[model samples]
Target: MKDVVDRIRESPKLPNPYHIGEICVLLPKDNPDLRGKAGYWGVVSHVGDYSCTVQTWDGDYTVKIEHLKLLELLDEDCQFMQQLCVRLRQLHQVASRDSSVDWLLQGLGKQAKPYLSSLQAKLLAAVEREYKLVWKQPKQN
Candidate 1:
């Protein structure tokens, strides 16, 4: 199996602004069809030469080498990174204050209401469930 170094080398020569565990603001490469719109901003949970994993504010996405182009490190991006850190801290605080499941349910209920479509709602629920599972404390009864 390939190791981390191998994965890192596989990517293009351009330096990536993201580091493992650092939050990043991601945007889709320029595309006419997309009207040059910015894509979702997310946290860089893992970065390898061959692949990167971004935990977006809305969901998680596994990005391959070919799909990536490192965005510029900017002040706005820094602000988002700070926000992500604060959000993570808040999540931990809430989870510790009450059962994680309860905290997630309450949080999700408040956060997910804007997606009106049934399919979108289901998908969001599934994503939230996975996130909760990934972060849950094993000691909780």
Candidate 2:
């Protein structure tokens, strides 16, 4: 039994199969730090031998390749997700600094659906406006 356990521990890890720009869902069962982020999707920003940096709505997280499940989406859908990621990141930053509004922002961050309904999007915008969380568009050069 001891020898078997040792052999298992010594076994080589599998190569990472994911690539940058790919979308993947987080599998947090094995990672305590990601406990509340299970099923959350993100874009792969960087890939290493065993782990990759995933840019989610809330933040960037470096997780093992085994902890991700790839999402097969159309190019347009991926573009939409990338835009949503930026919006969520801005919202998360605002919520982190304001304790009173953190609950609402956190709830939005927890949404697992890839698409938000029109009504939901409008409501989110309203909340952003009410809380002065809107992000200004950068001027083109």
Candidate 3:
């Protein structure tokens, strides 16, 4: 049992869904509950010990380890990418569709992630500053 657990943990095929856009395939041979999903692809939302949390068109599932296969690794921070896409689309509405900004944002998906993450933080701070956002303090337990 120890050796089996060790091997599972050490397996390079195990999906580590640290960021958004990490993809996985379902291997449902050993699990009847996932039989309908065999060969289907899912996006990893979170990772767990025995199972990973994956999102599909239908919904998210807590899938067992043996039922998962790593498909694609994340190239950048997904949340930042999603937010940037939304903001860029809004900017596109104000500017021309073929504007330089739209072209630049499209290429950011392959850029180094740490810089994008820092940019995301700064953008959020700017929004808060411009809007003067504040909330009441929460009560302590």
Candidate 4:
């Protein structure tokens, strides 16, 4: 079993082979700053030769491409993810103002799912309401 695992680990794999705008999950094992943010979803904002800048709900992170696992979501789903990103950002801002909400934020940060269920969405909305965080529509340019 150990030999098999070693062989699998030794297999050739692509590194930093991702494009901008792609959705990916962070592998936080190697980064102390991202310790509790493992499995969080982020969108690639910039792609460099060895690393990519990913925009998450909390903030932007520049990590090696190899540390990300691309999430193949549908076009519609991708759009939903973008919207969710905005919502999460708003919620995070509100949560930051009150340290009591840290648990909620921590739980959200650990979400590994590519999408949230209806109940989960409703629960998040309820939390936002509790915090008086209103969702504002984007202004037309």
Q: Best by lDDT, which number?
A: 2
**Local accuracy of candidate 1 as per-residue lDDT tens digits, 1-141:** 578889887866875545765544444554332232244445567777556786644345666544444444565554445354334444444444345544443443223122225764464345446556333322523
Candidate of highest TM-score: 2
Candidate 4 lDDT over 35-122, as tens digits, reads 7778888888898877898888889999877678988877666666766777777777763456645555555655645577787777
User: What overall lDDT goes with each candidate model?
Assistant: 0.48, 0.76, 0.52, 0.75
Name the lDDT of candidate 3: 0.52
Q: Across residues 10-92, which tens digit of lDDT does each residue of candidate 2 receive?
A: 99977789888878889997799788888788888999998999998778999988899888877667666666777767767
lDDT (Cα, 0-100) at 91 in candidate 3: 41
* Deviating ranges (above 4 Å) for candidate 4: 1-16, 95-100, 136-141
Per-candidate TM-score against the hidden true structure: 0.35, 0.72, 0.39, 0.71
User: In terms of TM-score, how similar is model 3 to the real structure?
Assistant: 0.39
Order the candidate numbers by TM-score, best to worst.
Answer: 2, 4, 3, 1
Q: Relative to the unseen true structure, what is the C-alpha lDDT of residue 81 in candidate 3, on a scale of 0 to 100?
A: 38
Residues 1-141 of candidate 3 have per-residue lDDT tens digits of 999999987887745434445656667887777756665555667777557776643346787766777654345444333344344334434433334443444344223232456665565445434445432223545
Clash count per candidate? 2, 0, 0, 0
Give the distance in Å from residue 95's predicted Cα in candidate 4 to where it truly belongs: 5.8
Measured with C-alpha atoms, the lDDT of residue 38 in candidate 3 is 65
RMSD of each: 13.2, 4.3, 12.1, 6.7
Q: What's model 1's overall lDDT?
A: 0.48
